[model samples]
Target: MQSTLYPKCVLRGLATTTAIAAIAWATPGLAQESEDPPAAGDQVAANPNAIIVTARRRSETLQNTPVAITAIQPAALEAKGTLDIGDLQGTAPNLLITQQPTGSATANISIRGIAFADVEKSFDPAVGIYVDGVYIGTSTGQYLDFFDIESIEVLRGPQGTLFGRNTIAGVISIRRTKPTMEFGAKVETTVGSFGTWGMRGVLNVPIIEGELGVKFFEFHQQTDGYMRDGFTGQRLNSSNSENFGLAVRYNPSATFDATLTLERQDQTSKPYFASAMVPGDAFCGFVPPGACGGNLTDDLYTAYKVAEHSGFYKADGVTLDMEVGLGAVTVNSITSYRDSDESFYADFGTAGLFIAQRPQTYEQFSQELRFAGDLFGGFDYVAGLYYFESDYELDQSTFVFGAPAGGIGVIGHSESYAAFLDFNWEVFQDVRLSGGGRYTKDKKEYEFPLILSDSVKKSWSKFTPKLTIDWRPTPDMMLYGTWSRGYRSGGFSGRAGTPFSAQTPYDPETVDSFELGAKTEWLNGRGTFNVAGFYTDYKNIQQSTVITADNAQGNETIVVNAAGAKIKGVEADMSFEPLDGLNFSAAVGYTDSKFNGFIIGQPITRPDATIFLQQLDYSDVDPIFAPKWTLSLNGSYTIPVGEADVTLSAGYRYLAEYDQQIAPDPALYGALLAQDFSATPFVVPQNDPRVRSDAQNLLDASISAQVPMNDSGAMANFSLFVRNLLDDRGPSFAFAVAAYPNLWHYGVPREPRFWGASAGFEF
Candidate 1:
């Protein structure tokens, strides 16, 4: 069957990529080198394909790393205008990162079909985010701003053995630029649409010449949001943020080194515009008779009568890293401490029918010690011990019609201990076998003073393992197969309405994955292609459900262990530089995910007013955010003009339609059917269009120029960039709430087209 979502142009591009791959595979000798190579005077003669990465806790070239990873460097990030983590959505295969609706710093990141999108501190993120070897335990600050970053690596599959727990989906590793013993400074400013403006500055100072150095950086930005309040005509989603950090590097001797970093971030933003798809009964009374049937406004970016409170977030962190060399072995230690406070208000109904304010404070401390070096003649090993402890307090208050309805106060604590070891052995010529294992123990405690009289505690333990075999037949080609197991820690529900629900704990979810991959380079080092196919057996899935509670005015969200699932996918990435000063890259991902045994209990009421639970089967439902097809095409060309160089770059991405919800509630449909016999037939949740996201085709473009000032290595750079150039106003996130007599649907639209210009001077 032909797909309407895939345009002809995209199909042609895909075909071209396929053809190139075929030719390179079928006839590697026929590949020709670029006639005109880049000039030697070009800034930094770094080879894109040979970029270094630390996917397995060791530095290795990207083409030689036996993992499915994408590394983005400073130059590419600048060309693509990637400012934050959310801007990396389409740059990788089978990866989606979006900021949550109410929380500007919270990121809902999905790798493959696994995702977790809750703001509560009790819930652990499926994807692990690491910065300079320190793990971020909460989602609240995972959407980090990019500045002075050395590289960002997105690893596609499970990284449990190396990264420890809560990495069943994948891992995002961000490495920051280290302090240099040199005197340098850089300053940049930006101006854009919607009253957007920003400035950033970086300074490096040599404290003790080659012994000690320090780097300081600061960034500030503000924007008048595109969304506006429908009633007051005031900006609803404006944002402001400030970030500053300092890093000190001390290398007194070649045998030992230490680096200390202190950082802080402050952010304030109004909530995203939540548009009511179907007005609830309470909201209907406030509107005209006919106006209650559809949305509140025709404009997707407008919210009617939303709360006026803005969200605020503040965070402080400190990290210390020390490394000691011991003959054939090296010892590394990392200690980190972080604290954060956040307050946000959300209006789901958009008409003040239901409003909730959440205030939270969190703090965490972690320590890690690792030893890495050559164990023997042909074997290398890395072992680590990790300990983490965290505590958080949350207060939530709900209001209905400007009157207090219900709320909950929660205190939570979590502790984790882990030990891991990995080794690589070269058993034969150009062939290696690698294996690793991690044993993790997690303990969680929860207290809800308002609902529960006593606190609850639970503990879970698991051991994850990984094995891989790779063979390099040639210097530029690698073939590997891997088997790995990973898990996500389980915990109690923090958003529970009743004491019983709050005390109940859920089991951990696990995934056993098998992958086969090939990394190859052809065209005399001008073209590179990598492909991986993986199948995962997912068990004990932790699924979140919202149900109406008899003791509270609002619904409660609970996590339950569902039966299992199967996920399989293929990912391919290709980069080619067929001509001098021109480059093209393509990334394609295809995933097929389905629940094997998903069963839920649906409460049904009889005519006599008695309620009974009925078993409902939803195994056929597709996983959320698991689009069947995702493709990205990017190209850039540079031309030397006198003493300056100009570069033009463009990118296009396509995402197939995917379901946003697990499945439509059968009880809600049954209730509606009983009210009216002529109601629409019950469509399968997978086929229901109401809960599905539209296929998206996004385009972005940028042009940059760099001019040299003098021989002192001073340069001026300027760029103009546009995101969402076509302005596709599709809903990025949506959900339906059962409101007794009706189902109230709410949606948050994607950002519109935005254009910005930036200029910077560096020495």
Candidate 2:
């Protein structure tokens, strides 16, 4: 374990070296032309054989572009056994997605410490998700299952260069496998311990003289619960899911093509309740052996129970894309409709007393249109217009003492329209200049429906602009600088906790960012490296405030922009093959984020006249959940045995400790920092200081043997695979308790090491 401890940046050199070696071994006898290595002073052209990416709204080779991006093709995903978007986090640098303790339905995506502060209907994710160029409006609908996908592109850093709002961190673009000229199908199934079972299949059917094609895919997964519930005599934290998708592609002619795709997913899981805290150190001496803290259910079980969850999500849309060769001009149009609904029970409790009866729901829709092409020698550009409208409604009904004492609900509609333009000038063959701007007008309206006297609604608007310059002095290197702006619209509040406080509305938040980056390919594309540094100034940061819900008229607390914050960081990514049959990739990111200026005080509007001695706030510190450093390394080797192949993969991930909450109140502050706050008697058990960061190593290996199945070139392969062979427990969470330091409890622990085997045939 003490082998050379190289940071992610240093590891880049190693990966590059390995890649160069691989290229030489791969093309030993290939003919080399005078321009085979690319002239030192010429601009690097894209690989003619590689699939072109439309990340910048144009089809271009990844190597030829100056943007910082990571592309995962379908073949690579299958080889790595990645089943969903979340699984790619470990494989990609500067990207992280972790379960929110709530459920897998909601995932927290972090990029360069920029993320969505809220995960509710009224708020949107900081990273934009696009499928076939259609923007996904809500995070709730972002949990898409993979099936016959062509590729996934992750663009790091702000994407205002081409993508619009909500792309503060970056963008995730999923390209689904389109209808092909020929027919093909693939089916897969796996079974393992804990009664785990999964089955998936895809089929392609060609009809009407190969002019029309249809493809469908279906996937189902189910598993027994890892934890047993004594009271209910049932499984605890069980997981199950069902997903299906169908797409029809029409190629009436070579110049025009249209596709209609529909998808549906159903997921259900049991909730894992939070563990209770133990007494202080003083009682550690007299307390019984089991009562001090080992297992939560050993001593006492609270009557409060968390409700289970079961939900269905459906997404359907039609995309019409037409490309006509009209000299140098290109025109494009896109329109989409998306809708989703989800309802679940949540456990909102303090101490051992559970607050059951909490239910929530949401609905939304959106549309957009754009066009681009080269007009004259002075500039080549794209201009577009967008329109988005969504409606959401949520209800928070709590049952205490077997009665609905606190009931809350809110309905809101948000709409926005914008026009933008981005253009580039070929200042010279080695240098190009680009600039873009957008003007947006947003409006929102909210209604209590059950409480407010006058309809509560408001409208706010803003304008954002961006500029970029790409300078390629050599075919092997590209350098660029950008200045861009990002914005998030205002939103409504949720139910209140206390009675004395009134509902609060938040205003829009905006950020102005400056960045410089470079991409380089050395050793004739055997290895590649990308690095970027950025600084962002944020204003009107939104934060959730817990308030009293005792008023008869109605008590509600909302998410509002309280103050400003700042973030700056450096990120690097590199990959290469050093030895024949050996490939390696690694990514590392360092972020420094914190509040710039802010003040906090007890609200004078509250009816209670109690004077607060002190309050917990992050006015001088960074927001919690922003890890200081993230490093990941993955390597694999393929060995050939006769006519068979065996591949072994090993990887490790290390993360620095950081706070989980934006700011703790008086009661939670001391426990989070592992300090002593005399006035605040309660401490958070899961936020204990001992559990700072998570470091773990994973080993996975697979062996496959291909045997002739028939006279045809087709063959059958049998394989065996194992994951998490060491079965490390990873890290635990810390929580607050009364009169003591934070308590530590592990997360929904991962599955232990499991082994399985499969046999399949391919032609």
Candidate 3:
């Protein structure tokens, strides 16, 4: 497949984006959750038109919940072609999902002013991703399918006391549809741009009516990439994936219920397209001719190469949950286990001149037990004890094509134990106070037989607390304030690249958060408005820096901690139904963050194949992945067309630019760091290294119709969607290579415009 690119503008914008992202990556890894999931069915909201979220471990309307959160349901996901959390990028305020140049599976997600940017097996996630209430342990495969999902909820800020460890940034909670006692089957298919084709199906079985039931879902999809290898006339970034799952539920009585779900996912794809690139009008003295023309960020590669033939990912998991009535209290249990394996290779130079390899395997198990009930004076409480364990192994390697590779192998295990309790009391008819706390103990171990002192061990324990106060002036409005503390456990950067080992583990990062908010409803149930402001005092910030050593082996990397950081932000979302059949929603956010102290790190490479440190000043760097301003707007209209209801929807998003500058000119880099390292640096005349990515805006639209299917209340629906309707493009994440910065500078282009049709039936 060939892509239609707006080269002239893209090249100009690509330069700025690449520089800023590079700086961000080397900074903190804070990931507040992103996006807004759909509301839960018929719960919490008295208005009957509000989104209900479980962000606080209880059902409540989004507008009434004090915490900041966003939600999206399956309907909106299908219409927008959202297959995973990554696809929600831009649509959500202050949310950024940047795919690693290596592969989409290995990526970074930033919410608000926080991010989990570094790509390493041992690095813990600043943001916790939970599926069906089970924590996803690794970054190796978080970009998977969202088959048969009920909703996705993105919670922002420090939810330490409630969500447990490593939720310093926030959490993403995903819920799947539960089994229904009905006999039915349905299937949907779609074909679209880039030779893309897909099918999704669901089957429901009624074993004993309401007493016992089971449901099954499956998906198959394939797509030719948007780019092609000009050398071999083959597709690049192509993918094939399959997913299936089964869920069973048993409800013997009104007060007791149990559910078990088993699922598996597999994916195979060609590595991302990579080819050496140079600015238009720049001389291609050492590169191919066309590489210097077009000023393209994405290279229409002249060659095809992959050390691993085909990239692959595989995973399977099972979850069991039960609830039983114990006198006046309810007891609940959640147990789960998951395993995954992945291997992939890509061209580091985009010209296929260099090759890279990354392979990993991991497994996790978790168990939680909690009790909840209501007591006197409108006092409500929930208490739980939780246990979690995981094991991981990874192999990383990189080298020039047709040459020996330099790399490292890492293996490790982790364990966590925790106990928590939360209580809420209605002090008066219109005032409420809530308090919660959690204590956790964690331990980790990593071994590398190749290194003489190979084994690394670390442990930590902490008590996190939170307090909230709410006042309801009326049944339709609320004002709230909260104070909370969140913690992310420290770990060993004992990887193969550098000599840094277990003896000196980095300190855990912590955040002290303060927030204030207001949620209100007007015009009956047709209008909703919410606003929140937050400030976070972050300490012991984790950071990754390059360490260059020109020897028999290549460059390596190690991570350390910074003094601290301070972040302040505000967000607002509103929805209104002014017209009889029309609805409008809009959201905006602003953030300001500082490192709090001087920051001096090493220079980052353009090729990105290795981490080689070249002393540089980072004292004035902006916050990583935290845009100054974000805006989004969406609206939909529905009208009756004969016997069917037809609807039209449109949405738009914009992100204000933040600093993303680094070394872009090889000559300038040589003048800046090469000489300082006592090594020869490439030099050029009047070199310019300062670069930036401008603000970006995107638009999307969709149309759909639904018709009834007999008296059984079944329905068949069809829809058409066009994403990136304006064909916005250029650069999102751009960079230059260390070995050949000037000749190898390039960027990851945003997806081109895409149009597709979908049809599905439910009975």
Best by the TM-score measure: 1
Q: Pick the winner on TM-score between candidates 2 and 3.
A: 3
lDDT of 1 by residue, 294-357 (tens): 4422455666754576799999988887766555666677778788889988777447767789
lDDT of 3 by residue, 1-763 (tens): 0111123223422443343334333332221121222324443435677777888776667766778787765676676665566667655567766665454365566677777555566787778888878777766566667567888887888888778988888888889878886788777888888888899998999999988999998988888867665546676677888889899998755555678889888888876543435453122344455544443333433334433346888888877777655545666677777777787777653454456677877777777777777777578788998877877777766665457567667788888899999888889887899989999999998876545365788899999999999999987899999999999888877454545443457889899999999988989878988888999998987765433334223444455676688889898888889988798888888888877653434444434445454434343466556788888898889899988889898889887765332233444554544444434432322212222345777888899888898888688889899888887665555544333234344545566788999898888
Regions of candidate 3 where Cα sits further than 4 Å from its true position? 1-45, 101-104, 275-287, 291-309, 494-496, 501-504, 550-553, 598-615, 658-694, 732-747
What TM-score number comes out for model 2? 0.81
Question: Which lDDT values do the candidates have, in the order given?
Answer: 0.78, 0.58, 0.69
Worst 10 residues of 1 by lDDT: 34-43
lDDT pick, better of 1 and 2: 1
Q: What is the TM-score of each candidate against the true structure?
A: 0.90, 0.81, 0.86
Worst 10 residues of 3 by lDDT: 28-37
State how far residue 411 of model 1 sits from its true place (Å). Answer: 0.7
lDDT of 2 at 11: 45
